[model samples]
Target chain A: MKDVILGIDIGGTNTKFGFLDRDGISLVQGELSTNEGETVHDFLRVLYQEVMTKFKKIEDEANLIGVGVGAPNGNYYTGTIENAPNLKWHGSVPLVDLLKQYFKMPVFLTNDANAAAIGEMVYGGAKNMNNFVVITLGTGLGSGIVVNGQLVYGHDGNAGEIGHTLVNVNGRGRMCGCGRKGCLETYVSATGIKRTVYKLLADSTDYSELRSVSFNDLTAEMITQAAKRGDKIAIDAFEYTGKVLGMKLADTVAHLSPEAIFLFGGLVRAEEFLFDPVRYHMEKNLLHIFKGKVKILPSGLGLNNTAVMGAAALAWNEMERGATA
Target chain B: MKDVILGIDIGGTNTKFGFLDRDGISLVQGELSTNEGETVHDFLRVLYQEVMTKFKKIEDEANLIGVGVGAPNGNYYTGTIENAPNLKWHGSVPLVDLLKQYFKMPVFLTNDANAAAIGEMVYGGAKNMNNFVVITLGTGLGSGIVVNGQLVYGHDGNAGEIGHTLVNVNGRGRMCGCGRKGCLETYVSATGIKRTVYKLLADSTDYSELRSVSFNDLTAEMITQAAKRGDKIAIDAFEYTGKVLGMKLADTVAHLSPEAIFLFGGLVRAEEFLFDPVRYHMEKNLLHIFKGKVKILPSGLGLNNTAVMGAAALAWNEMERGATA
Candidate 1:
């Protein structure tokens, strides 16, 4: 039987699962609603039932190898999911312990951003790079830094927190949900783009399709659509967001000197509208020594497949390391 | 016979040489003036004479294993010093090729900042760490970043040029020597401190020992002495410098997440006057996830012996790597 591994991507809203083979191919994929019930245990029970049913059907054709998980606040060192913001789970959840009961094999877990970095390294754009950084711009900004061909997990597995670096010391102090002021995420995320649009609308009399949308009603897709149609206000909002992000990226490049920086997540889909401005400002702000050298590219893996592939890559990396040792 | 390495520190004005054992113990150290009137070939003749005298004296006591030289624009990949700004040498000086006439064994060359990083890794404070950054605050700011226990040499072997990163986009637009405007080095170096002192003097009519000193006459040591004696303007100069450095460091930490940052060079002698303010602002600007976690520490190695020790460490590292490979 061919060897297969279980890959899981745990989100606050939904949990995605896939059966991945040795060659980085996914045979089946499924998803379930998360945080719908009162407790994490309730969600786990239903998730296990669905996974078991799926696995049994494939057991005749594939041999189960192990399980890997990617989630918010997942700790590679401790195998637990700590108190992640926006999620109903309050305390440390022993995810590896719970998953062990379902599959009796080696299990690995890491933060979602880190998992994405591993995915890029193993099967996507960063396959040839030994050092690179991955930035995920969604509802919030997330990052995973790869140094010397390995993920950097500091003392408490909280090393990759690039989103929280302050870009503007005195300009429009927006409080990040992380309790920080003027963080990169405060000006670069989808939430940040909406904030910029609202601020621009309030300050100027610029007419646009987005002027009617409420704060809760505004979405990144709408802004991208309007910008594509030559909406001045929408275009300005993306430019403003990209400038802040590019400046922050310049500072990051000075420190890491990575071969490349990979962008992932939903907001990156805006493509040229966001990337052109970001690239221009990043090069403009970069030091002469690093200018025109570092490549900033989008992740090649699809959203649904990347997380699962990354989780599986973590197990594969561990296995390789163990074999070498 | 005991294994010994020749350590050479090539400064723009003077070249220091020392004989060291594997344990980093210096047997003998001396300095030679690099006469500006002499051509590159003439200067090497003088350097070789001094090296021969020292080697002859110790030839019976130790076995000469290798030679390592650290200089301003040294490139490890090419083993050459390329267009060092302060030195009269105008083009690529193949240092390893020159050294081969005297020693037949391995000869290595790297930039001074990288040498200092190797110093910390082999015999100083960073012995236990695999990830850290070393900042040399001398005439100008120079840095060496180590990620995952290896030195990062970019495509052109000119990585770790953090000082050239722009800290202020629209503030004082001072032209950097690198043909850039408002670089971090333009505001954080010894020259930067003097500029700040002059700016402070012009802004305030306060009594200061610094007021009478001309820009060409002022020195970093004098500024430190005045700040230690409660000179308000002098104290403020250091605080201003530290604030810029701290904010820039916060941005750096967000990218690499190094375990610690090591400071070296003559300017770092200000110690508390500079460190206190740097520490305060760094902690203040850091993300909550990294606050109070990373450390800012002074170089444990003595200034008088650091150059030779650092060069010696480079030789040791090269030898070890060769053996392992």
Candidate 2:
């Protein structure tokens, strides 16, 4: 039987899972509603039933070796998901411990962004890179910093919180869901771009496709489409978003000096609209030594199943470490 | 004979050297003028001669096992001092290779701030800490970030350049030696504090002891003394400096999330005149999860020979790594 590891990516809406071999080749894939059950235990029970049903069908073909999970606010050190705003769970959820109750193998967990970083290292462009950063620009901005080939969990297992860093120290810029004002995520994420488009519409008298769209109904894709049609306000929104992201990225580069920075997630679909200004402003603001050195590139992982692959890579990395240790 | 490590700290003005046992106890210490020699080779030759004379006196009692050197712009990976602005050396000097020729033992070279971080890990208050940061606030601000018990040398061996991170993204701010404007170092270092005093003097009309001091004659100590005596401009300078430092530190915390940030070097002597405001503003700006968690503490290494101890710690750390490898 072929050895396989189970990889699970938990989200606020849907939960995706897949089984992969050591090579990161997928064997089976599936999904379920994260909001299905009332409690975490109830949710795990449903998840266990679904996994067992799937495992039985593949048991004769592939032998499950271990499991890895990527979720919002997942802590690699504690194996818990703490205070994740998007999830239905209330407090710190012992994800690893709960998963262990159903799976008779070693289990590992980290935030999705960190999992993506490990995926980059183990199977993607960063396979040869010892240090790099992976930024997930979804509805919110998330980051994972790698140095010396190891993920920095910090002292509290929650080190990669770049989204929470302030953008405007003095102004009441934007209200962050974290109950703070002017967070970097407030101006850089997919939601942030929508927010930007609305602000631009209000600020300028120039005609644009976005003028008719209401904030509650508008989406990032609408803005992207408008920008493609040469909508001035939409284009300005992307520019402003990139400018903010680039300035913060310059600060990030000063601290980590990573070989490259990988941009991943839905907002990355905007492509040049986002990358161009980010690259320009980042270079314009970079310290002399770091200039023309750090690469800002698209994620190497295929967009379709990147999160699942990342979770699998985390499992593989841990197994390799266990073998070596 | 007791085995010892020869530690050397190269400064713009003086080069200090010391012999330290594995326990970090100093056996012998001496210094020589850094500007005495015409070339780097001449400087090394004199340093070697001075080291030999000192070694000859202790030959029967102690044995030198290895050497560690800390200098401005030192690169751990390249083992070179690359275009140190403060040093007389004009190019990348292969310091480790040069030292290896004279010392028949292993040698290592890294920036002084990194050495100080290793010193904190091996011998100071952070002995148990696996993740921490050391900020050197001398004429310029320098930082060394540690994660998972290893210093973050980055891909280029120059990861920690927190000082160069921008403070003011717009408006012509303080000019930096790095050809950048509004860098964090321009507002937080010893010279930064002095500059702040001058700016305060210019911005405010209140009478103060610093009003008479010229820019060339102003020192950080004079500012501290004046602040102690309740000089308005001097006190304001310290407060402004702390606010700037604390704000930048909050950003630093977002990236690394180190257990503690240790303040070192000349400006640290200001004590509460600096620490109080830094603590206040850092807390005020820290992200919710990180608040009340990261400690901002004074360096545990004694001011008299901190650099020497740091360099020696680097040698010891490398030796231990070599043994394990």
Candidate 3:
């Protein structure tokens, strides 16, 4: 029988699952509503049922060897999901423990960004790198730092929180869900660009297509589309976001000295509109020694497959290290 | 004969050497002028002669096993010191190769801060910690980041340069010897406090004993003494320095999630004058998840012998890892 690992990515809106072989080739994949069940246990039960139904289709040819999961606030060390804001689960939920009841295979989990980093190392552009950072830019920013070929879980399970570091310290700046002001995420994420567009509309008299979009209705895709059409406010928003991200990344380089920083998630789709300014400002702000040494690249697993592949990569990595169920 | 490792710390002003047992006990320690020779080879020759003479006194009880040297801009991966601004060497100098000519044993070389970090792990307060940061506050700030009980050497072996990260982004700030402005060290080191005192003296009309001292004559020790005596300007300088250092450290904690941060060197002698504000501000700025979790502690290796112990620890550590000359 062909050996396979199960990869699961639990997001706020949907939960995606896939079965893949050692080379990261998916045999089957599908998604379900994350809130289909009333409780955490109910959700996991449904997920397990859905996964088993999918696995049975290939049961004769493929063998299910292990399971891996990626989710917000997932703790690699504790095997729990700790109060992830986007999910309905409000307290520490023993995710691994619940999953173990369904699958008698080695199970591992980590925060989505860390899983993405592992995926990058095992299957993407960072295959040869021992030290690098992965930045996930979605609704909010998330990061995964790798050093000496191992993910840095830090002293606690929650080490990669680069999003929350301050960008402005002098005055009360942008408010963040974490209740902090002037955070890097407040200026660099998809929501960050939307916020920046509004601020630009307020400050500049220049005609912009974004001027008509309601604050709640505006999206990063709309802004990118507008910038492509020569919208001044949208273009300025991307520039400002890049400036903030580049400067903070320069600081990150000083701290971790990663070989490269990989940018993933939605905002990266802006392509050169985003990459150009980020590369420019990151180089401009980098210390002389770090100049031209660090590369900024896109996620290599392809955007559609990142979450699943990340989870799969985590499972494979843990199993190789001799971790048991 | 008892085995001992030779530890050498080459500073701008002096080169200190010590022979230490595995238990971190010093067999003998001494210092010599760093620039007594006209060239790099001459300096190494004189250093070798001085170390040999010192070893003769303890030769009956000690057997030399290996050597470890720490200097500014030292590279562990390359075993070279790369154009350190404070050192007279203008280009890459093969420090390990030069030291090998004398001992014929295993030789290791790394930056002073990295050596100190290894010392902290092997002998100091962080003996039990797997992730921690060490900040050396002297003429300029230097840092060593320990993740998973190993120093982060980055891609080019210059990972821990937190001192060069920016604390300011607007206007022309204090100039750094590294040709950058507004670096963290420019505001938080020994010379940083002096610059702060001068700025404070110029900004306010408060009565102060520091008003009589010139910039060149002023020192961090003098500032500590003045603050102890209730001199307002001196006290305010320490407060400002603490505020900046604490804020930056909060960001560091966010990135690394280190269990504790150890402050070392001359500036730490300010005691509560520095620690109080740093703790308060760091606590005030830390993310809720990290709040009250990370500790700010003094270096457990003490002040006078830290360099020697650090280098000794590096040598022993490398020997255990099977690195040889």
**What CAPRI class is candidate 3?**
high
- Which residues of candidate 1, in runs, are more than 4 Å off? A36-42, A170-172, A323-325, B35-42, B97-102, B170-172, B323-325
| DockQ sort, best first | 2, 3, 1
> For chain B alone, what TM-score does every candidate structure achieve against the true structure?
0.96, 0.97, 0.98
Compute DockQ for each candidate against the true complex: 0.51, 0.83, 0.82
lDDT of 1 by residue, B189-212 (tens): 899899899989999999999888
lDDT, candidate 2, A122-186, per-residue tens: 87879999899999988899899999999988999889888888887754579988887889999
Clashing pairs in 1: none
Candidate 3 lDDT by residue in tens digits, A1-325: 9888999999999999999888889999989999987999889888888998998899999988899999999999899999999999889999999999888888998999999999998888899999999999999999999999999999998898999888877436899899879889999999998889888888889998777779889999999898889888888899999988988898899998889999999888888888888898888777898999999999887788789899999998888878775
Ranking by TM-score: 3, 2, 1
Misplaced by over 4 Å in model 3 are: B170-172
lDDT-better candidate, 1 vs 2 = 2
Q: TM-score, each model?
A: 0.94, 0.98, 0.98
Please state every model's RMSD to the true fold in angstroms. Answer: 2.5, 1.6, 1.2
The docking quality of candidate 2, as DockQ, is 0.83
- Per-residue lDDT tens digits of candidate 3, residues B198-239? 999899999999999999999999999999999999999999
Overall lDDT per candidate, in order of appearance: 0.83, 0.89, 0.90
lDDT of 2 by residue, B92-195 (tens): 89999988889878999999999999999888979999999999999999999999999999999988999988888752479999987989999999899988
